[model samples]
Target chain A: MILDGKALSNQLDVNMKAEVAELKATGLSPKLVVIIVGHDPASQIYVHNKHRKAIKLGIESIIERREADFTEAELLQLIDQYNCDDSVHGILVQLPLPKHIDEGKIIRAIDVHKDVDGFSPESVGKLFNNSHEHYPVSCTPKGIMTMLSHYHIDPKGQHAVIVGDSNIVGRPMGALLLNAGATVTYTHILTENLSAHTKTADILIVATGVAHLIKAADIKPGATVIDVGMDRDENGKLVGDVDYDHAKDVAGAITPVPGGVGPMTITTLMQQTIELAKVADHRTLQPVR
Target chain B: MILDGKALSNQLDVNMKAEVAELKATGLSPKLVVIIVGHDPASQIYVHNKHRKAIKLGIESIIERREADFTEAELLQLIDQYNCDDSVHGILVQLPLPKHIDEGKIIRAIDVHKDVDGFSPESVGKLFNNSHEHYPVSCTPKGIMTMLSHYHIDPKGQHAVIVGDSNIVGRPMGALLLNAGATVTYTHILTENLSAHTKTADILIVATGVAHLIKAADIKPGATVIDVGMDRDENGKLVGDVDYDHAKDVAGAITPVPGGVGPMTITTLMQQTIELAKVADHRTLQPVR
Candidate 1:
């Protein structure tokens, strides 16, 4: 069974549109501060998608484009500015900001209430805590759970092995899997005998940006494979970390590239944005959807 | 090879003395804040040991005893007061506070820097994030690692299962084990076939708070068990989560009750206090020793 995230995203968009209408009727449009540093075409396309999605949902999207030379202090000051501003309901800092700026510090600076990206240390901490009410979860992991539900696959009694140890994907993914009652093992570069564990996962998620890194040999028959990587194969075509053709034959279900997890991330962002906007008042202490 | 935390705690105390002296020579003293609610005899003893140990290390330890009538706001104000005080290098809030107070809120209120107890959400978050610098680690898990190393037990490639899921013990223990390259599984009330998982662990740590909950029949041969629970048995005497008589004969190594993970908690508190004091001027964070 394919986990059609595009369909799930559409359903989420429907719910968000209704929520946004309710907010708009009250004369308060959801305003999200999207900060992008430097000019990468890929990032520009992502920002455009997010901006259009927000506008389509009746939420006001505030695009703040900073020059490549913007200092880390100045970026932090901007975060402080949004934290104090009553109108700003959510904040999203586009990743791969210039290498000089400390991404961790920048993410931590965004007030947890405004941290719709769920990159803030507090949000991470809140998610790590058993009670997930205080912070918004990272979008992609939340989307993964949403995607899993659509497939009617429960992680309970399952072993999930996540490839890669990224703060954005792998680490939060581990917590997300654990939250759903799955036994999770997070592996990185230093981990030994990687396949020995990967083949045992009832659910395997490959996020390492290595094209075709996982083959049929690395999977267990009837296992569920999730490809979160967007990389090009030797033939210069888009391929996932898993060798989709061979891996899928041995797998029970798989999420393919292009229309799979990719569409879910941005849609999750918009859904979280409207959720943040709906509960803007007393946002600090309140729960985000 | 046994992971003797009590011996390591003594060694750590010895090391803390020299570091405290170095800080004193620079006109700074490591100060740890200890806040306890009501008069639980056990908490009193724990606080006393911490204070005495701090004094031995040439650091200053301050105890704030509040009556059970204290409001949550009042407790938060106290935490805020210490959070702003640069003199207080470490803050330790003794757990088992009155049920009326919001423990999570109070723990979050303590500035992450001064959170020596490492019970704060940010500390836990920083821990889960690969190589986090600021959030102080939960002390017991940190201490357990030291004990493991002292006994030359490395968890690399080991299947380590943690029973119980307390924020203070089991949860953080799982994160630390994951960080150390162990295949980690955390189980609580919901986990099925508990013995099936427990019996496979090459290294097992039980913090279920149920006296003698883990039996020899449930542990793998030659496994290393670290008991972090202290409970009164039917005999009205304190016993650990592991049934020592049976486990000791079957397991390759173990840390005994009273001198095991129990004493290491306060010992780690003092060690972190000294380390925090030494780094007061320079904001460089210390690695978990």
Candidate 2:
């Protein structure tokens, strides 16, 4: 069975539309501010998509556009302005900023409550702590959890193998799966004999940008595979980390590249933005226990 | 061979003592302020041991003892005082506070830099992220890592199994071991068949407070076992989660209850305190990359 992120995302959007209407009825509108520095083609596409979706979902979309030479201090000043703006509930800064700016410093500057991207150390810390408050999680991992739930694949008691150690996806995903009661094993580039771990996974999530790092043989017989990779293959075509053609034949459920995790990532950003707005309105967001 | 925490901690103390002397010679002292509320016998014993060891290593030890009826607001005030005091290098609030005080709230109040116990969510997050900069790790797990190194037990390429999921030990231990290049699996109460995972471990760490939960049959032959359990048996004698008398016969090496992990926890606290002070002086603590 294919984990149809596009279809599931559409269903989620329907619910969000209702939520936004309810919030509006209560005189509260969800707001998001996305800051993108420079004209990186990929970053431009992402920023455009986010802004478009925000408007479609009835969220007030504000984009702070800057040139390649934006100073670190200048970017931080913009973040501070948004942080103090009660009207702004979600603040997202597109990644891969110019070399002149320290991305980590800029990320830390975003107020934790308004950090929609969930890249700050405080937000990351909260994710790992699985604290009592609801904080934003990385979109990719949050989306993957949605996919798992959509397919009715319970992580509890499963042997989960993650093929990356990145903070944005693999690391946080590992924490989430562990919290869900799966005995998770993390295998990174440094891992010796990666297949030894991969072969044992009941659920395999691969996020290393290395194209087709996992093939059919690396997957368990009927494992659930969530491919988080978005890379170009030898033919200049977008491909995921898994050999989907062969892997889908062997795996029980899989998510396709272009339509799989991509759509859901943006969808979660919008969902979490609405959730953040609700919390900002009532000052109460229950922890996801 | 016995993995002797007693002797290893003694060697660690010797080095820490010299480090403290060097800092003191420079007119700086590594100081720790331990705040204890109520007179729980166990809590008192832990506090007494920590302050005693702090003095032995020339670290300034200050104990703020409070009555059982101490309010949460008062504890928060005390934490605020330590957070601002330039002379205080580390602050520790003894656990199991009176029911009126929220332990989590008090822990979060401690300055992450001064969190000697490493119980704060920020500190725990840093530990899991395996961040470049040094932050205190929970003492018991840190001691276990020290023990592994003392015995030349490299976690790289090993299968490490943790048999509990408490925030302090099991969760962080899995992260530490994974960062060390091991394939780590965490088994908790929710684990379907506990022995199924335990039987495959090359390095097993058991921290469940349940006595003799893991016996000889549960261990893999020649596996290294580290028991973090501090429970009393029916005979009213201190025992560990592993059935030591039986497990020792099958295991290659193991830590004994009273003399093993206990002393090392305190020793690691003192070592981290001196390291924290060094950073305070030069402001140049390198990341653990």
Candidate 3:
């Protein structure tokens, strides 16, 4: 069975339109401010999609544009502006900031409460520590969890194997799965025997950016496979890390590239932005201690 | 073979004595401040051992004792004083803090720079994120890693299983093993079919605090087991989570309860304090920007 992220994302977006309107009726409008540096075509497309989704959901959207030569200090200043804005509930700095700016430094500077992207160390820390207070989770993994629940796939007690250990996907995904009561095994570039680990997975998540890295032979029968990779085949067509044609035959369920994890990422971002807005509004209602 | 944490900890203490003296020669002496509230007998013994180890390593030690009824505000105030004091290089709040005082609240209050215990979320975040900057790791996990190296057990490309997910030991232990290039699996109380997960380990670390919870059948043959449990059996004899007598026959190497992870925890705390002091001094030497 194909896990249709696009169909699910569309359904979520439709439901959110009403929720956003209800919030607006109460005079609390959710707002997201996205900062993008350079005209990196890929990042531009991503930023545009985020903006479109926010507008569709009745969210107030603002995009701050900067040249490729934007100084690290200037970007930090822009983030500070959004952090202090009362109307802005969520802030996202599109990645691959010009080489001159330190990405880690920029991420550390964002207020955890306003970090919609969930790339900040504090947000990552909260996710791993199982913090009591609610904080934004990284969109890709958060979306994956939502999809699993939507499909009625419970990860509890399942053997989850994640290929790749990138901070953005593999590492956080491992933490999330472990938190959900799955025994997680992480295989990366340094892993000695990749197949030895993959064949053991009850739920396999691949995000190595290597097209067709996983195949039918590597997957266990009835395993649920989630492909987070967005790569190109020799024919210049989009492909995921898993060989979908073969894996689909063996996998109980699988997500395909382009139409799979892609749409869900933007959808999760829109969802979290509204959640941040609702949380902020709730805080305002509480009498000052 | 028994992995002798006691002998290794003593050797580390000797080396640290000379290291601390070398730093002291530079006129920046290392100091550790331990705060204990309500003197639970177990906490009292642990605090005393820490103070003893600090003095032996040529590091200054200060123990702040508070009554059982110490208010959370008063505890925070005490932490603030130490945070500002230039002489205090490390601050440790012994665990099982009075029920009235929120332990997490007090932990977050400690400055990360002085958090030798590594209970703060920031320290933990740095560990999992593999941050380049220096930060203290939770002592028990740090000690286990050191023990692994001393025994020449490289976890790289190995399957490491951790049988606990507590914030202090199990979670950080998994992060450390994963960072060391191991495909790590985490099993906790919530884990179903626990033995199924345990039997696949190349290197197993058990810290579940359940006496004799793991038996020979649960261990993979020739696996290196690091038991972190300190539980008393029916006869009131100290034992570990692993049934050592039975496990030693099947396991390639293992640690005994009394002389294993227990001593190394305090030893790592002392070592980290000295390291923290050196890092602070290096920062001071940097030319003013």
Find the candidate with the highest lDDT and give its number: 3
Candidate 1, backbone clash total = 0
**Ranking of all candidate structures by their lDDT, best first:** 3, 2, 1
Tens-place lDDT per residue, model 2, A181-252, is 888778887777888789888999999999999999999999999999999999999999999999999898
Question: By lDDT, is 2 or 3 better?
Answer: 3
Sorted by DockQ (best first), the order is 3, 2, 1
Candidate 1 docks at the CAPRI level of: medium
lDDT by residue for model 3 over B1-289, one digit each (tens)?
8999999999999999998898888797999999999969989999999999998889999999999999999999999999999888999999989899999899989998899987777777777787776778899999999999899999998989999998899999998888888988888887788898899899999999899999999999999999999999999999999999999999998999989998999999998888778776773332100
Kindly report the root-mean-square deviation of model 1 from the true structure over all alpha carbons.
2.9
Chain B vs. true chain B: TM-score per candidate: 0.95, 0.97, 0.97
lDDT of 1 by residue, B1-289 (tens): 5567778788877887887787688788889889998888988998888888888888888999999888899999998999899999998778888999988888878887787887776777778775556456788887887787778889877878888766777778878887777777777766767887798788898988889999999999999999988899998998999999888988988989988887788777787776676566674555653
Native contacts matched by each model: 0.40, 0.44, 0.49
Best of the two (1, 3) by TM-score: 3
Give a tens-digit lDDT track for model 1, residues A55-155.
87777899999999999999999989998998988999998899889998888888877889887767777777766565677888778877887788898
Q: How is the predicted docking of candidate 2 categorized under the CAPRI scheme?
A: medium
Which run of 10 residues does model 1 chain B get worst, by summed lDDT? B280-289
For candidate 2, write residues B126-178 as lDDT tens digits. Answer: 77767766778888998899899899999987889999988888888888898
Better of 1 and 3 by DockQ: 3
- At residue A161, what lDDT does model 1 achieve? 83
